[model samples]
Target chain A: MGKGILVVLSGPSGAGKGTICKAFLERNKSVRLSISCTTRAPREGEVDGVNYFFTEKEEFEKMIKEDKFLEYANVYGNFYGTPKSYVEETLNSGYDIILEIDTQGALNIKESFSDGVFIFVMPPSLDELKSRIIGRGTETEETLNKRFSSAADEIKLAEKYNYAVLNDTVENAVSKIESIITAEKCKINRIKDHMDVLQEV
Target chain B: MGKGILVVLSGPSGAGKGTICKAFLERNKSVRLSISCTTRAPREGEVDGVNYFFTEKEEFEKMIKEDKFLEYANVYGNFYGTPKSYVEETLNSGYDIILEIDTQGALNIKESFSDGVFIFVMPPSLDELKSRIIGRGTETEETLNKRFSSAADEIKLAEKYNYAVLNDTVENAVSKIESIITAEKCKINRIKDHMDVLQEV
Candidate 1:
């Protein structure tokens, strides 16, 4: 409670979760986005530590064995994980951190750190979400159906989150997230100053 | 969960809780202020519904017997209580309600409606609080010490509250309270609509 909050942001692929997270970071410069560790090689134009902390497959597996990752997932033949040390150290330094992950990753983090704030970004409706995915203009009918069904599955897990933000407008969603951060700081458990100040008086 | 929140605002008399609650109400019109019912007769200028809901002693006792109050206490020679029906009705219609009560009354409400969000407001220091009370120029030295000690006692119980606002400045305190209200609304348990919407889709 003395340290900064660890916020987990999750949603469907086209729910604008990333946009809201970006807007939050822009508005609150002290808040940082967590850089994930991945076993995959860096793609073209991607920078190490900027895009991700690319690690060898053996190193990733070793970290996983050591429980260094808060949550990890195996996609295709590559592993991607959120390093626990990075998150803990950043929060200890009094900088709030936001982690953008899929629904499965979010649930994994919940098991590891139940105290972290969990937020589920949602579209106004499934129809709106379908239209948003269509607006991307790059999906085949098969992939689009897969994505639509995946989104349907993810939305059902929204109940597990502590908060839900309807991503209807970027500005409105960002404002609400900002307020949530401010309010979390005022929680009785979070204000260690109150405990210390009263002790001296 | 479809209903609005019932927020309990409580603190010592000189802690500026009233000012913060008033500021919150002015900013959020949909959030109503809860009016208590009292067996004692209203003062000359006090109006029913606007002030306290005046009640006959027998009727008040009857309501108490019938479990019609969220909480009730016999103060001095009269009984004052929060009418359960009024609070439930307001929340049922989708309007959030804030109840400004003393520390004792706040504890009483906690017993009956534990879901209500409780917030405690505090002064920067007991010395500052004493000065503010003295600035009123209406209290004798003896009364001043009583209020000061009372506030100190009340602050010790602040950890029981869901949130605490240090009233360093009226504007800052009001801003924090507003954020708290907004955050509470986003709570997963409060927004059951998210679950319902996903099911329909």
Candidate 2:
């Protein structure tokens, strides 16, 4: 059998990527979601390794120097990166890994792994996006404006990704994500590799 | 919402393309199978305009001259071609169309309608392909051998397809074909067109 695929998914804040990711995991057994490692202090009710593999800043920087991360970024004085070991372990175990990272992190990961399948999720419409953000009711008007402005910039980066999905409905979006993983598995290169093994056998 | 996608599938004899197409249509409700028109005489129990649109050779040649067929060719002294009108009518009615055509016909269709998704199905192995060809039990040993020889040449052409699915198992193969269609719908160009329309609104 051939190795599993590395699938990277990204979208703007209000695009419902998280919901679709959860739905996809519930339906598909072959996918493994990649949990990120963070150098930030854990907050209340957050586990050390569940929400994130929390690490000290010194340890994070040391690993960075040692080339242990697939991609790392500093946000608001907190360092976050995808651990290389976990990904390799899951992929080697024959489970395809799903990395629900942001656009910048997706780009960084792509820089390291050229063959990774990158997918971008989009909101059905700008007005629908605003409605979703407002529906959250956690942010102030000013903060909501910031999110909307950031969405425009993020959608532009979507053009750089390998595939783009429209989040028109939760079911539709998750179905597309699942299908992408299936299609990536059926790629000629990967299938050829399987045939090579059969030939040898 | 935009229209559904059109997929053109082709593979060598005994490659299990027919089985995959059948399973895919059973699973996906929006897909419509395209029946090709041919000048060849229908075999026993074959229904007119169902298995194929059997027509006179002169009529087929006339349609070719009129550019009515999207792709047409002469095979075994009989003309076969996809009619453009029926495909367009079904597509305009908001259904995806699957064309189970030969590699040459697929390439010809791709030339004019570049947006159609093309997939090639291959057998798990060369030995398995021979077994499948013989398993049909309809073809004589001599004819099966001829087809097996041609399968080697067809496998080479499989590289030209956008996606190559190995018909290792009917269920798994169907899942991949369904995935290809689902993933193609999530393409940025299609979503971007929707977003553009919304922006105007």
Candidate 3:
């Protein structure tokens, strides 16, 4: 075994990314979901370290100045970031880390860390996505339409991703991503140490 | 559902690649081994279409001039080559085709068909490889030593392969190669049509 893999997952709102991530974590014991640091207050029932490392705005700014975040973004006045130390520690310990992020944040991480495997999850169809968003009932007609278009934009961007895992069913998607991880670990680039040892022998 | 993958497999002698390919075909119903055209006469118990597409020397030269072969070679006055049309037709019909070639031949295919997934199989260790080769009970001491060094050279060339699957066990190597096939199919470069249709929706 070598260093752990950094898997950066991104998908649109109705793409079932969160649900799939939940199932993945439940199945793979060696993998852990990366806990994000945020200036926003945690919701009810959310654990401090488990859900998010709730941080003060000034401290978050200080972390930014210190280059402590892999990638960070401000959305609606809330600063959310992926802490650098925890991810590095987990990988150095030879445990895989899954970073669930949106497209902009994923792109930022990709630029900084080219070693991470970037995956873009997708729904089967946009029509299904529209219906799912509509089924939520919380969104008004205008917001629903906005989200539908946003999904299309995200799908277009997926062409840049290394892999596109279709979330047709949670089970199939999970298995496909699992196979991707297994295959990645066998890549020639990742097995440099193994090859070096073999060559010397 | 999509165009089939061309998997080029190569390794040193006694890597058990032949056994692994046999098991792979038994397990994967959609995949078939590619048949090459050769000027050498069919061996005892070898069928024409099943074992090889045996052709006359003139015919093989004509096909080579016609650019019908993906890669061709002359060995001990015998000509052998992978026909371009047969492989394309099989893959076009959505059946994966495996080409079992030596390191030099595999590198030639890689240069021409970048879409083809190249895999290198390896023994668990050099000592194991030496023992396996000696167990064959055919080679003299001098020839065995020559073969050992040849294997080392082949292992060095494996750095260019897309994935390296260690032949620690036939089952494990076959399973990893299957996973690699699955993962390659999910790559964004291979799913342009799916992305296009999703974008249209």
Candidate 4:
């Protein structure tokens, strides 16, 4: 079996990246969602190793010192990180892993895993992005303005991604992502081993 | 409208490149089949401009001299060439064009159009390729051996292609090609203008 693709899915907050990722996971049974390591307390029903490998702050900091995390960030005060070993094991086992992260985290992952597929989900328009953020019903006017401005800035980073998929609908976005994965598998760089075997034949 | 992709479909003689290209064109309404210009007389049912733009030998040579043909070759005394303008016009109009050519022709086109999506179709195995060639019922034992050896040599050049698709089945191969085209459209390099427009918004 071939090594699995490490897909880093990112976009602005209101671009439906989460919904698209969820739908893509639902459609593709072979792909796994990369579980993160966090120092924050688990929510009511979150399971260790499933939702996250919840750890104490000291242990998380130790892992950071060991360079065990592919990427990590301190949100507010809690630390959340993608464990490098877990991602490496999943890909080595020939199971694709999707990491839905912010643009900053995605760029950090790029440094460690240059072969990873970076995809940026795009909102149909700025106005639509505003409506989606407002539809969440939790953002204060000030926070909403701040988020909208941040999203606009993040959209500028889309050009850095290997591919940018428009989140016009969950189904369409999932299909496009599926196509990207399929095409990446067929890329010549990924098939060198297979080519060697063919040559021997 | 975004620019269309120029898909170069090539493979060994018995790799089913033609079948896959035909199936892809049948399924994708937006893609056009690139017609070749040839000095050979048209077959009984073949239509001009549809099957080929049949031209006199002098005209074909003049085109070669003028550098109007993207790639051309003399095959068994008959000249066949791909018209560069027809491909450019189709792509400029935002319609993808599928060029079903041989490996040499494809590599030649690459020198001129490096951005073209180069896809090499592969038969399941060398044995299967030989069987397929024999199945065509046109080769004698001697000619079969020659064709089979040539196919083996051609397979080695597949590494030069951007993608190598196994023609285990025509349906599957066409679907993979479809995915490749879809994914190529999402490539960041192809969407620079779209990105500029989004940034402006």
Model 4 clash pairs are none
> How well is each residue in A1-201 modelled by candidate 4, as lDDT tens digits?
789999999998889987888888889888899988888787667799877899999999999999999999986467989989989999999899999887888988998899999999989888889899999776679878878878778888988899999888899989999999999999988986865436654
The iRMS of model 1 comes to 1.8
Q: Candidate 2 residues B97-179, lDDT tens each?
A: 99888777888898898878889887778888888888878776777777877878877776677788878899988878888
lDDT of 3 by residue, A51-73 (tens): 78999999999999999999999
Question: C-alpha displacement of B44 in model 3, angstroms?
Answer: 6.8
**Which candidate, 1 or 4, has the higher DockQ?**
1
Query: What digit string (tens of lDDT, one per residue) describes model 1 on residues B91-198?
Result: 988888999888888998888788899988878877777778887676668867777767777788888899988898989988988899889888877786634556
Which has the better lDDT: candidate 1, or candidate 3? 3
Clashes of 1: 0
- For every prediction, compared with the true complex, DockQ reads 0.59, 0.45, 0.62, 0.58
What is candidate 4's lDDT per residue for B117-170, written digit by digit as tens? 999998888888887888878656886787777887888888899999989899
Displacement of the residue B114 alpha carbon in candidate 3, Å: 0.7
Considering the two chains of model 2, state its CAPRI-style docking category. acceptable
lDDT of 2 by residue, A1-201 (tens): 678788888878787776777787888867888988898777666787666889999999999999889899985468989999999888878789888877778888888888888888777777777788898786768878878788777778776788887787888888888888778777676766566523533
Which model, 1 or 4, shows the larger lDDT?
4
Q: If you assessed candidate 1 against the hidden native complex, which CAPRI class would it receive?
A: medium
In Å, residue A180's CA in model 3 sits off its true spot by 0.7
Q: Write the per-residue lDDT of candidate 3 for residues B1-201, one digit (tens) a residue.
A: 788999988888788887888788889977989988888877567799877899999999999999999999874367889999989998989889998877877898899999999999888888888889898766668878878888888888888999999898999999999999999988998987745446474
Off by over 4 Å in 2: A124-145, A168-171, A196-201, B26-29, B135-142, B195-201
lDDT of 1 by residue, A76-113 (tens): 36788999888999999888999888788889899979
DockQ of 2: 0.45
